[model samples]
Target: MNTALDPTGATAAYLAKLPKGAVETAAHYTQGSHWVLVIGKLAAVVACLIILRSGILPRIAAMTGSRNRQNFAVFATGFAALLLQALLLMPWTFYADLVRERSYGLSNLTTGAWLTQSFITAVAGALVGGLLFIPLYVIIRRAKQRWWMWSSALLALLIALATVFAPYAAGLFNRYEPLQPGVVHDVVTDLARQASLSGEEIVIYDGSKQTDRYTASVTGVGGTARIALSDTVMRDPVDIPAIRAVVAHEIGHYKHHHLLILAGAVALLSCIGLIMAAFAFPTALRLLGGGGVGGISDASGIPVLLAISAVFTLVTTPVVNTVMRLVERDADAYGLNLAREPDGAARALLATTSYRAPSPSRLEEVIFYDHPSIESRLRVAMEWKAAAQGR
Candidate 1:
């Protein structure tokens, strides 16, 4: 191999190219990823309207004796739709995450293992959501009149609870026990470091079990800090320097406390939304079924919840993207600082981008990106390299 460096390769880089149309390859068998999300959300929204309009809501309203009985009816109906939507979308989620990953040469999980993993994720989400949300949702109703103040307070409590509960969540959901840190001596020093932490720990969930991509995350509530890397990351994105680059970025999430910040933001927004829903739900309920406004009771709460859900979905996309970009920027720097190899980081971005749209449309990235676009991450990585060499 002539290991010659190009002008573009101001930093030493080595990696292989990715295979073709992995996503399309995935779509050959099942509904596409984007289709699943759009259809799921839209279906859930529509389901909500039908349940409210077909006398179900009025019946619930009549049965409840609370002052905010109408609000409860509307909330319950919307939530039921949400719960169902979550359940129905699980198949699509499996197709994209597990089945397609294997098709495109990424996943290594057998069907039984895949099914077990999916079951774990759902149960974990339900348990964590139930404990944190049941109280929060109950509180929201109690504070309907003082919606913003009490709702925000409740939301904050939930996030804190979630953070504290993260480790337990991971333990319950992770089908495999935490792998020994030395097992990844081939790369992933930072992952190993995080994994070895005393109070908080990391559990590698083998993202490759369903997809070919290497991924790692630290998620949960209070003392519940946990991190995990996929088998894909361990195998495919295994270079020590490149791995460090990614680890730096993952570390940024914790250093910057993204979960806590996101939780607080959700709390504040939800509180305002709770008060607004008291007024907004009625309109949303009516609009849901193309019916007149008068058909809904507690016009106040119904419209607001519907409006809040819509607004949350819309605004959160861009806002969360900006935060991710910022976090990514910081993480790239962390990699550069810790590994002293921006080229490795840049190359890592390129090798993996084959599976994910490396150069997605701005709208696409804004609407959907959970991480920085490959180009954006590369640009930042290059700048860091230039700065490191004092160029």
Candidate 2:
């Protein structure tokens, strides 16, 4: 397996020639899309509240005479509202996921394929939300004041279950196959062995079917643990050594058990968010012209709960992003040490600059970037190279 670094500085020169304007244009689109999503979500929540307040939800509930039927009515109402919100957000989605990607030359998907995938995602989200909210409403109905605590526990369990089952869920979106035997395969397998992983744990997936972005991930835990590489990584423009370095970084994540650590952090935050929501929900509902704690389980209360949850998420974004960046830095360091290929790491970082800003401002990095910016990562790799050469 060839693990050689680029000897002539050619890769660095090529990366330097990559258009800064392209990066800026993509960033502008991305930032605008984020604000659009936030505003659209709030608008959707307001619409749901209005519909509920105008006697629509109550009339729908009245259509069902029995208690069980009424509960189903609540679920149906919330699900329909979520689907409506999704429809309202479709223009933003098209611009961000389809048009912007095409403009950046990063997407391979046709409009039909994009629409089909979007529909699938929306339906999946509605199903998941309905499953959770049914029990959530029951908890609110029965537990009253302590409902938040119980609901948080349920959320944590569901998150944990989702983490364990992620590989299966991911298969619904993309196709995976064993990587063909070759130099790339050999390098990946060797890295896997160094990371104490077996051959069966590595596979390549058809990521290029949707996007030109390069990505790899270690998904699931225990027997389900597997490392998946995007087909884009094995194609031209990304060299063999850089691909090896990327695999090493993913193995670092697996070796460090970052997935479980992240899951735990999210579970803890969910608990905190739920506690905050419990205190905030009654006041928020009153502000929305809805009844107080007595109506917590009402279909009208769903939007209030969601709106507060969104606020909690927005307020906590920095904390969550900080933790994620730290974990990513740890993986970068681990991969650098294990791969012993700083140039390869630098080249891999450069590949991402096609979509990510090469050198984001500190505030932008802190608030929006979950991974280290390309400049920061390349600097780290260069620093390591200097230290290693001195030794």
Best by lDDT: 2
- List per-prediction Cα lDDT, in the order shown: 0.56, 0.75
Report the C-alpha lDDT of model 1 over 29-113, residue by residue, as the tens digit. 3234455556555655654455445544344444656655444544454444344445655676677666766666666778887
**Position 84, candidate 2: lDDT:** 57
- Candidate 1 TM-score versus the reference: 0.70
The lDDT of model 2 is 0.75
lDDT of 1 at 18: 35
Report how far off residue 157 is in candidate 1 (Å).
2.4
- Model 2: per-residue Cα lDDT over 156-199, one tens digit each: 98887876677567687789888788888788878877776753
**Which 10 residues in a row give candidate 1 its minimum summed lDDT?**
295-304
Give the lDDT of residue 17 in candidate 1: 43
How much does each candidate deviate from the true structure in C-alpha RMSD?
5.8, 4.0
